[model samples]
Target chain A: MAVLNEKMIENTSLNRKDILWMKIIKQRQLLVLCVPFMIFVLIFNYFPIWGWIMAFQKFVPGKGIFGSEFVGLANFKEAFTDANFINAIRNTLLTSVLKISTSFVSAILLALMLNEVRARLFKRIVQTISYLPYFISWVVAVSIVYMALSPSSGIVNEMLVAMGIIKSPIAFLGEGKYFYGVVAFSNVWKNVGWNAIIYLAAMTGIDPEIYESAIMDGAGRIRRILSVTLPSIMPTIKLMLILNLGNLMNVGFEQVYLLSNPSNIDASRTIDVYIYTYALRSGRLSYGTAIGIFNSTVAITLINICNYISKKIDGYGIF
Target chain B: MEKKRSHDMLSKIGYRRMTAEDLFLDLFIYISLLSLCVITLYPFINTIAYSFNDAIDSVSGGIYLWPREFTLRNYEKILVGNKAISQALFISISRTITGGVLGVFATLCVAYVLSRRDFVFRKVFTPFLVFTMYFSGGLIPTFILMRDLHLINTFWVYILPTMVGAYNIMFMRSYIEGIPDSFTEAAKIDGASEYRILFTIIFPLSLPVVATITLFVAVHQWNAWFDTMIYNGMNPKLSTLQYELQKLLTSALSIAATDTDATLASGDSQKAAVTPMSIRTAMTVISVTPILFVYPFLQKYFIKGLTLGGVKG
Candidate 1:
């Protein structure tokens, strides 16, 4: 890292205007190396930002962005009034907030528990199993949740019935009331271990001497953890919390889309799914574009707000 | 030695002696971790059990912990002579391999260039990459861009748009930056070109991060279904296993909900024996099996790589 920074200084020392041409000629290989990536980024990443102009247009498929009629916030007005759009925002926020809290708490607890374990092999084994679901796609994760909660052949329903917890099988997936909890729990189950890894890493960063000092002061295991470990990792915890809260608008479209059916659509619709439904399926391109812009704006605002709050509360933030 | 003193201290503190409070804490930790392990694993186990159980008997629903009436019929139907499933699987596997290789190469190229100390473009391009992480053009415009590029519904659609991820490029660049400049500087002094230095020297040293990122890209490509659903849903030949599996499950559920009684009462023995429940479970097992198989072995490297990102952040 130091070498590269030093090299940058050495090469930039040529103040003479004539030497600039020679420097460019000498660095031809590096220039050649950068062209392909620059072209790809320009096309794929930057081009889309230019495409956002469609949000202001009465876009037609063949008319192109240049030919499309400039409507000027008409699409945004429509999106704000649309019931489906409003419902999507509500559901997206509700699900994101629920998932963020549950997963955060579980991950912290899991990390703390893992830290207390004395056996190395046991810790490794536990970690391996915990992160297994992280590798599986939402398609697979939703299917597992689906099969387990199936009203007919599902083991969960069967166990509940046997234990007299319910009079009969409940269609857990079919009910709107249970949708938030189901989505939140399933998201936590899949990501808890993966999230725990960050906390675990943060725990390792805490000085061992602090723990020894606490032990000398006759602090018990739990006491030491409370007094030393938690406070030491508080900065990481705050950073992660702020980062996650910043992404509160993204409720993971795949989970809701896959798990949703006619019975659960009312509860499951989110901004991403709503965009796909309207823009791609119905071809209401301009309205979807407006809503998409709205979604991203809200997310960026939330991130900035959260980062500011974190900076004030703690001394650090992602920015 | 420090270790010996720690060991002595451990014994002195009753860590080895096991006081009642220590014993209680130990027991509590073990039980909690073991239960967590069970909870994490039970869903997979149950899916396997359902896949193996007799479809007809599974509906009565006493099957727990293991299959009651074992059968390979589910596997046979899925694995043998089913053109749709076979095609989807083939497409998925091929795309994962092709996309993984191309993605890694593209990411490595861009990251390597940006990692260069004296590259004038680095200052200009770095912000271009970082800006995308915080904000984007969003769904519709990106879709339109793809349409304009004629990438929609084509095989290139799957591999091209995602070929260079901003996050991956940043991580890879940072990893490369950590490589001492002396190595590349000495090679440059020996008349080595940038490409030669990258491939011969830097690439070999970067195997760990490279492997980690490659596996990540492979897993992502393998599991990806959203793009397939959106861009290429009309093209069956381009369908991935995940997309197919999703279709299979939803269709199966709707069919079961509407025709459960009709199908059962018709008394057609073979159809009755292999219910939609069994087929869905079987498909779930088949699709996830590869990830489950490879995950345990590669988990250590993955954990290290992920934690590296966490700590760096």
Candidate 2:
């Protein structure tokens, strides 16, 4: 009987191919609709990926990826050995870690606080106001930061002097030590509310009876939140954390670029910035591609590892 | 045990009532929220204040919350001072609308096709879309490709290369999946073509996601300067508002670095009266005002879209 079923399936698949062609003919317009998009994806996405071969080659302008010398792992080795490359990687990781932790905490706290708000109007207004910065461009945002922290003419310096907190203005952007903190804080301020939306959504899904029961058990609002709300949202928290862990290397290019200058280059030169400088600015195409290859490889590996761990822990993975 | 029992009894009596603890908590929450609101709005307020103040007076500093010596000259300069400013504004607006509409349409096409469960080619194409999200050719090769394609230094490069976003396509696909298969199946039985069913049915049902992606794309286009910086490459005609703003700030910084105020003067005496700081503030205001204007009405949709992605995605 099993042999007969297998034979029938094989026969059906043969027929299925004919049916598929029929369906294609029927849905010919849909295929036409998808054609332009497919071409776009190919040119914009796949073409670039195919060009990654330049990372392995001594790529010259006229030679193209095909005609270039395939020195094989030499560029990768060169990238790994460079002090600037290592610094970029280090800076990327440091800022990413700082940003992830700070934003994660801020989002959680804000979401919790928002959840505690009794007045609907107040919560909505606060939430609305907070998301404004998220929509503002980093160019504008960086300008705001620069103006606010400008040594000679900044509001911060003025206020500090008025309050006698300091006799002189401190060059916030000119220092290396403050760069990570500044980037992290600015990032948190911009994204905290937006990030909190996910947590708030998860909170809304928590069963109301759990909170009722906690209250019945004489737990205060804080205690109820701790025992009921936090526990219920642990999966979401874990999910977001793992997702963020995957992006540990992408310390947002725009923010770093806009904020970075010669003074803060020591702390601000992330991998993306480094690649941009080499590849586009200096026109060291092959060397930059090699660094990009390194950056992407590490990022993909981190994501996979995080996905693996997430699955192991919770039977759920992004992939 | 007795104390616990008494506490439970007391709590049960006042479960609906605000206790002293609740009162304190409410106070803390309100104070914290208000403070946060102030902090969030302070820089924006400061920018506005600086934008209106006299340029030279602003250089003396200490304009914190409001314009000290109020004037409309800075805005006048931005509006009528330079043709590039208005030109950049037009470019920014045009690109935002054009890019947003086309981007959404292109993304939706990929998403709708991929959403079809019976499409035999979906397995092949879905991975093609998803693979791009994780890996890319990197900067130089892609730039080289754009340069080779002659897409460099053109407006098409802005819209075409970014026409489709992989994550957005996936998000839309996930959204479309939530739409019942029965509707499409019924349409199929009625002899409605796939495109007909998609346009007539799926498109209407997927408005929330569509609106979400539109806002996302529009905001991105509006905020974009890096592309202009790279692709446009000092082509003043193609520069967007944000790019022009960056240039203004950069030039101002460079000037501030070398000369104090004498050589900073431009041919336009009106603009020269407004210090670079004030001019920059005005430019910042110009850059942000449009987003701020439209944000309130669109805020709910963005929040909804995010939660939709969070839950289903």
lDDT by residue (A112-207, candidate 1, tens digit) is 989888677999999998998998999889888877787776777888999999988878778777889989999888989999998998887765
Per-residue error (Å), model 1, residue B210? 0.8
TM-score list, all predictions: 0.92, 0.92
Poorly placed runs, candidate 2 (over 4 Å): A1-16, A161-167, B1-17, B181-186, B251-272
lDDT of 1 at B304: 71
On a 0 to 1 TM-score scale, where does candidate 2 land against the true structure?
0.92
Query: Taking the candidates in order, what DockQ does each have?
Result: 0.59, 0.47
lDDT of 2 by residue, B1-313 (tens): 6543554554455456778887788788899889889878999999999899887777666778898888999999989978998999999999999999999998888899888887768888888888787777777778888988998788888899889899889888888988988878888888887778888999999997888888888999999998999999668889899998887666644333233333454433744486667778899999898889887887777677678778753
lDDT tens digits, residues B43-131, model 1? 89988998998887777766777999899988787778568888888999999999999999988888898898787667888888887
